[model samples]
Target: MVPQLILVTAFTLYPIVMTHVYSLFEWPGFGPLDRFVGLRNYTRILADELFWNAFQKSFIFMAGTVALQLPLALLIAILLNSERLYGRNVYRTLFFIPVVTTSAVIGIVMRSIFASHDGLVNNGLQLLGLIDRPIRWLAQGDTAMIALILVASWKWLGIKMIMWLAGLQSLPVELYDAAKVDGASFWQTFRHITVPLLVPVGVVVLLFSMVDALTAFDLIFTMTEGGPGFATEFMELYIYRYAFTSFAGGLPQLGYASAAGVFFGVTVFLISLVLSLLARRASQVRR
Candidate 1:
């Protein structure tokens, strides 16, 4: 147990410790660790307007995801939980295919599909006479954000559906029977029974989406790189740009990037803590 604990601590905490140490220095991430810059990197991050924009984008993504994603999952879960549904196993497997696929591949697919003027989405819209010309879905600001939100929701909804299905199934049957015996209507039973019982599942899904939004990198990286004028710029993508891009002294800002990463991590951590508290409060209120 002691040896296992030591390994776990080393594997997890070591990188974080190093990130903190590196953040205090002006290193290029490849060369020798340089002299301490004290809190310069952190201060720079604090002053960077781009960083704040990314942070705002992350929250927007979070709101869009939780608003649309989980309810869709729950609706599907309810449908899937119905005993009348045929071939439930087949439907479950089909939906979960996206969840099992490689995220990079998914990002690539999304990028292509949402391409401007020539992509499948635009082509379909043109066919439907929705627009005279191809709208640049990924190149525009509000629409680009909406595209990411939809893609993120689509890619993750299936897993949440399965989770909610499990939660629904685990719910004891007697509760429903009693509700029906009390002459409760379908809506009444659903409002009273289903909602109350599924609070835990909601909390879990909210936390999952929150962290995913906070640290979203691959999708945004592959999709936009926070581009078309930083409209869709997210925190993780912003850090990558700062650390790697050669935009005239942009590259080799390792200390600043690490500071940004630590700031993002701490921000997400505190948000998650607040959500945990909110979930607890909600559960208590329901009780």
Candidate 2:
């Protein structure tokens, strides 16, 4: 416990504290931290159109991934949880393979797969007479975001499925037996028994999925670098760009970036808090 506390303090709490402290200054990554413009960075971030655009994109990504991924993962998990399913373990392993794969590798591979010229998607679409010419999937703003969402949802689907599987497996076998004895149809049993029982786990899964979608950086960065005119630039990437990379041939704005980071962090925290409240209310109602 002492070692764990030490590690948490050193890695998490310290960084968070320092980030807040740095947000008051206008310092670059190095040199003096002399310029102290308290609250100015926060005000600037609020006024920045690019920052707002990135915020909107982040929410879009979050909404898209959660909408697409969770339902599909839940269905797959239910299927895999079935005792009658053949080679269920093999299927589980196959689904989970993508979850363990490196995000960078997935991003790079997906970029090639979605490329305009002779890419797998374009070629397949053309062969199926869906289109006569290759579509620039990553070269357009709207399509680029769609591609990011699809790839992100695919990559994280397995982990959510696994979470759902755990919840499903933990359900009381006696309730299922009674449902079977009472001649409840699959849909009826699922709706009345399974769905109610899964609320707690569903809350957890939803929280994780939302956070993952919001904080997604490595995959999007490696694949698109927020390119095609910043179409796919999410909040995390926006922070990274200001924190590390030089903008307009200027020095890295570490202080301003820290302010953005703090703002984003607060937004995520508020969302999580609301979700937790809803989860608590849900549990009380279930009781």
Candidate 3:
């Protein structure tokens, strides 16, 4: 615990303090933090239309991840965990391959695969007569948003599946045995036993999924670069661009970026804290 505390203080606490301190100044990621314009960065961030838009998009992405990805992962996990399944290990490995692969590489590869004219997506759709013409997936805002969600869901699918698998495996066999003896149907057993017991795991999964969706950056950066109009822009990319990319009209805004980072970080932390308390309450109720 001593060593872990030291590491946390050095890495997490130190960075957070520095970020807040930097947010109070007009620093250009360089030598002097001379200009001390307190709270201006936060004010500007709140007033910025782009910031709000990006924040909204983050919520949309988060919602999509929880609503779409979690259920699919749970379903896949249940199927793979079934005792009657053959070669389940092979299936699990194949499903989990994306989690281990580099997200940037996957994004770059997926971009080409979804390209309009000659891409595999378009080709396949045409082959199946799904559409009369090629669709520019990354060129449109709505389609780009969908692509972002799909890529994110696909990348984390294996991880969430594994988490669910662990929870399912930990469930006591006697419950199922008793259910079987009572002549309970599979769905009835799952609803009354499996679902109720997995509440704690569900809470953990919810927390992780929210954090991952909010902080999604690498694949998004490589895939669209927030293009096709700022439609796919997320808060993480928003902060990175301000911190790194200098505009022709303005200098690089390290302070502004730091403010945005702190703002979102606080928001996420509050949400997580609330969820954690709820999870605790859930555990108590279960007991």
TM-score of each model, in listed order: 0.91, 0.95, 0.95
> Scored by Cα lDDT, where does model 3 land?
0.91
Order the numbered candidates by TM-score, best leading.
2, 3, 1
Q: Which pairs of residues have clashing backbones in candidate 1? A: none
Model 3 residue runs over 4 Å out of place are 1-10
- Model 1 C-alpha lDDT per residue in residues 148-171, reported as the tens digit of each score: 898888888898898899889988
The reply for model 2, stretches above 4 Å from the true place, is 1-6
Q: Stretches of candidate 1 above 4 Å error?
A: 1-7, 248-250, 277-287
lDDT of each: 0.85, 0.93, 0.91
lDDT of 2 at 104: 90
Error of 2 at 150 (Å): 1.0
Cα lDDT tens digits, model 3, 1-287, are 99999999999999989999999998889889899999999999999999999999999989987898899999999999998899999999999999999999989999998898799988999999999989899999989888888888988999999999999999999989999999999899989998999898889889989998898899999999988778988999899989988851477889999999999999999999988988888778878
lDDT of model 3 at position 90:
95
Winner by lDDT between candidate 3 and candidate 1: 3
